[model samples]
Target: MVMVEVRQRLVVGISGASGVIYGIRALQRLSELGIETHLIMSRAAKITLAHETDLKVAAVEAMADVVYSPDDIGAAVSSGSFATMGLLVAPCSIRTLSEIATGVTSSLLPRAADVALKERRTVVLMVREAPLHAGHLKSMLAANDMGAIIAPPVPAFYTRPASVDDIVDHSVGRALDLFGLRIDIPRWRE
Candidate 1:
C-alpha cells in the first residue's frame, strides 16, 4: 500500500551482485531528495547483504518508501501503468541482466525493467560483474539496443575519490543522471 502519493517516483531493484551499497546509497539519496521509491530486492540480494554489509535487511527495506516482493508479479511496479520515472537495477547481476536482455523476466525485478522499457521510461542497469565474456557483452549490447542504459559502476578518477564511499557516490550519481535525478556529487570540471 503506497500511501504518500509523491510526485517523483522510481523503481529500484537490487540484485545479488557485489556492490549492494550502490542500491543502498541510491535509496538513501532518493529519500533525501523526497522522491518516492519502490523497492524490489531479490532473495539472493538479501543473502549477499549479510555477506557484504553489517546492516540488516529490515534496515535496507526501511530506506524505501515502498517495498515489493520479488515474486509478486502482480505488484504495481510490474506494469507500465505504475507511473515511475524508471527502473534502476543497482549492482545488476548477470542473471538479472540476461533475463532483462532476453525479455525472459520471471520475477519482478527484471519485469519492472521490462515494463519501464516498454513504457519508454529510462532504465539504468548498474551491472556489477567483472571479466565479462561474449555472452555478457552481447547481453549488454542487446539491453542497450532495447533502450536500457548498461551503466557499469566504473569509478571516476577525475573526482579524486578519497575512499570507497566517494567512488560509489560518484558512480551512483552518474547513473542517477540518466534518470534526470541529479544528486549533487563531485563531477568532472573543465
Candidate 2:
C-alpha cells in the first residue's frame, strides 16, 4: 500500500492562462512529496509562460518525470491504461475548458483529462478566466457534470500571504489536497 501511494502519478496540464506560476508551483510541490509527475503544456501555454513568467519552458518541464507533446494525442497520458491518479489543469484556459467539456480530444491534454474522467479519477481545472459570460458558465457546468472539479484561481485572504509566491503556493497546495497530499502549508482553523 505504501508503494501504491508513493507510485501515485499526477498529470499537470499547462494552458494558455495568465497564472503559469501556479502550474510550476504545483509541479514543485508534487516533486517534493515523491509523487511522479507527467506534464503537458499546450503550444499557446508555452508562449504564455514566456510572456507572463520568467521561467523558461524547459525549466518548468524539468519538474515532471515525463513530458508529453501537446500535439501528440497518442501519448501515454491519453490512454486510461497509463494509470495516472488524475490530471490537474492549472490555469485552465477557457478555450481548453470548452474543448474538454464538449469531448474534443484533439490534443493530449483534453484526451488525458477525458481518460481521467472515464477512469473516475480526480480532474481539477484551475480555471483562470474572469467576468465569465453565460456560455462560459454553461461550459463549466458541463465539465463539472462530467466529473471535473472546477477550481478557479481565486485568492484566499484567510491565508494572508505576503508575496505572490505565497498566494500561488496556497492555491496549488489546496489543489494538491484534492489528491490527498498533505502538503505543509498554513490552513485556516475553526
Candidate 3:
C-alpha cells in the first residue's frame, strides 16, 4: 500500500478593513504556490469588498480551496487539529483583533485565529487601522503576547514598487514569508 501526504494548507481570514485587496492578493499568491487555502470572511468583509473592489464575493470565495461561513463555528479550520500551516487575517479589522486578543471569538474568522494561537501555530494579522489609539495599541499588544504576529501591511518602499498591485503583492508576499514559503517578489538588498 502507498500513502499520500496531505498538501500544505493555510487558513485565510478577511475582516472588514479597507484593504480587501490584500486578502485577495494573498489568495492569488498562495494559489500560485500550490498551497491549499481554507478561507473565511467576516460579514463586514463582504460589504467592504463590494464598496472597495470590482470583484464580487463569489469570485473571492472561488479563489479558495474551501470556504466557510463566518457563523460556522464548527468548520474544519476552526479546530487546531485541522493541520494548517497557519492563519493569516489580511486586512484584519480592529474588532477582529480585539476578539482574538481577548479570546472571545464570535465568528469562524476569529475562532480560527484563536485556534491557531492555542496550537502554537503561526497567526499573522495584517491589522489595517491607522491613527491607532491606546485601546487599539493595547489590543495589538495583547494579541502579540498570546503568540500572534501583528504584521500590519506596511509596504516596502525599498522595493520601488511602480503600481498599486506591486505594493499589495509586496505586502502579501512578506506576510507569507512568516510561514517560510517564499513566493516570487522583489526583496531588499544590502
Candidate 4:
C-alpha cells in the first residue's frame, strides 16, 4: 500500500481572548480552501466562545480537521517534526504570548507554537491585547526575535468595513496571508 499526503497542514491555537471569532473564522476559511487544520483550544477559549457567541465548544472544535486538548502535551503539533506549515494563534492572549516568549509552554497551544519556532516554520500570533505595558511589548519583541510573527488583528480603516464581521474576516484573512495563503479579501488600492 502507498500513502500520500494531500492538503497542506497548519496548526491553529485558539487562546482565551476577546476575539475568539478570529480563530473560528480562520477554521471556516481554511476548511473552504481544503487546508488541513490541527486545532488546540485553551480552557479559557472555550469559556470565551460561550460568552462571545452562541456556538458550543464542540461546534467550534468540529470546524477543524483535527483537535487536540490544551493538556495534550504529546499531540502531533507539539513536535518539531510535525511537518505543518506552522502554527497560527488567532486572537493570541497576552498570557499565551508570555508563555511562548519565555519558552515555558504549560499547554499544548504554546507548546506547538514553540515547536514551530524551533523548526523555523511560520508562527503567526494574532495578538488581541491593547494598552500594552513595557512587559507585554518586551514579550512581543522576544517572540519576534524567536521568529514568530506578532500580527495583531487591527482593522484597516482603508477597507471601510461596514460590519464587525467584515473587520474580523479581513483581519483573519490578513493573518493567513503570513502563511502565503492569498485569501480574496479587500485589498488596498491606489
Candidate 5:
C-alpha cells in the first residue's frame, strides 16, 4: 500500500497591503504542495485586490480549502486550541503589524499570531510597508522580539528573474524554505 503524507495546515492572512499578488502566489504555491490552507482577507486587502488585479475575491478564496471572514474575531483561528502548523501574514500592513507586535488581539490576524507565538509555532510576517519610519522600525523590533519572522517582500536581482512571476515564485519558495519544504530554486551560495 502506498503511504500518503499527512498535509500540514497553514493559516494565511492577507492584510490590506499593496502586494496582493504575493498572497495570491503563496496560496497557489501551498495548494500545489498539497498543504491544507485556511485563508483570511482584511477589508483593505479586498480593496487592493479589486483595484490592482483582475481576479475577484471569490476567485482568490476558491483557491484555498477554507476561507474565514476577517471581521469574525471569534473564529476558530483566534483560539489556541486550533491545531495549525503555522501562520503567514502576506503583505502585512503597518496596522496589522503594529497590532501583532504590541500584543493587541484585535482581530484574527493578530490573535492568530499570538496563538502561534505562545504555542511556539511558526509565524511569518511579510510586512509590505515602504519608506520606513521610526514607528515601523520599533514595531518590527517588537514583533521580532516576540518570535515572529519579519519577511519583507523585497526583490532579489541575484536570482535573475525574467518576470514578475519569477520574483513571486522566488519569494514564495524562500518562505516555504523556512518550513523545510524543498522546491525548485537556487540556494544563496557564499
Candidate 6:
C-alpha cells in the first residue's frame, strides 16, 4: 500500500479592516498551493467585506476548508495542540492587533494568533491601518516581540504592478513566504 502525507493546514483570520481582499486572496492562493485553510472571520470582517468587495459572506466562507466563528473561543485553532503551519491575520485590524499584543484575546481570531505564538509557529499580521499613532506602533512592536510578524500590506512599486489585483497578489504572496511557501509572483530584483 502507498502512504501519502496529510496536506499542510493554515489558519486564516480576517478582522474588521479596510483591505479584506488580502484575506480573500490569501485563501485563494493557499488553495492553489494545495494547503488546507481554516478560517475565522469577525463580525466586523463580514460587514467590511460587504462594504469593500462584491463577495458575500457565504462566498468567502466557502473558500475555506473549515470555518470557525470568531466568538468560538473553544475552536481547534485556539489550542496550541491543534497542529497547523501557522496563523495569518490578513488585514488585521488595530483592535485585533491590540488584543493579540496585550494577550487579551476577546475572540477566536486573536486567540488563535496567541496560540500560534505560544507554539512558536509563524504568526503573520498584515496590519492594514494607516496614519498610525504611537499606540499603534507600540502594539506592533509588542506583537513582534512575541514572535508575530507585523507585515503591513505595502505595495511593491518596484514590481511595477499593473493593477490592484497584482499588487494584492504580490503582497499576499510575500506574506506567505514567511511560512516557507514560495508562490509564483513577481519578485524584486536586487
- Candidates in order have lDDT scores of 0.94, 0.91, 0.94, 0.94, 0.87, 0.95
Candidate no. 3 TM-score: 0.97
lDDT of 2 by residue, 1-190 (tens): 3554358799999999888888988999999998899999999999999999788999999889999999998898888888888999998999999999999998889999999999999999999999999999999999999999999977888988899888888899889888888787779983
Steric collisions counted per model: 0, 0, 0, 0, 0, 0
RMSD over all Cα atoms, model 1: 2.9
The list of candidate 1 runs beyond 4 A from truth reads 1-6
Total colliding residue pairs, candidate 3: 0
Q: Candidate 6: minimum summed lDDT over ten consecutive residues — where? A: 181-190
- Residue 151 in model 3: lDDT: 96
The runs of at least 3 residues in candidate 3 whose Cα sits more than 4 Å from the true structure, single-residue gaps closed, are 1-4
lDDT, candidate 6, at 38 = 100
| TM per prediction | 0.96, 0.95, 0.97, 0.97, 0.93, 0.96
TM-score of 4: 0.97
lDDT of 1 by residue, 5-69 (tens): 55999999999999999999999989988899999999999999999999999999999999999
Residue pairs with colliding backbones in model 3 are none
lDDT of 3 by residue, 29-107 (tens): 9999999999998999999999999999999999999999999999998887789998999999999999999999888
Q: Candidate 6 — which residues are off by over 4 angstroms?
A: 1-4
CA displacement after TM-score superposition, residue 101 of candidate 6 (Å):
0.2
Q: How far is candidate 5 from the true structure (C-alpha RMSD, Å)?
A: 3.0
Assess the local accuracy of residue 118 in candidate 3 as a C-alpha lDDT between 0 and 100.
92
Mind giving the per-residue lDDT tens digits that candidate 6 earns over 156-183? 9989999999999999999999999989
Error of 1 at 151 (Å): 0.5
Q: Estimate the overall C-alpha local distance difference test score of candidate 4.
A: 0.94
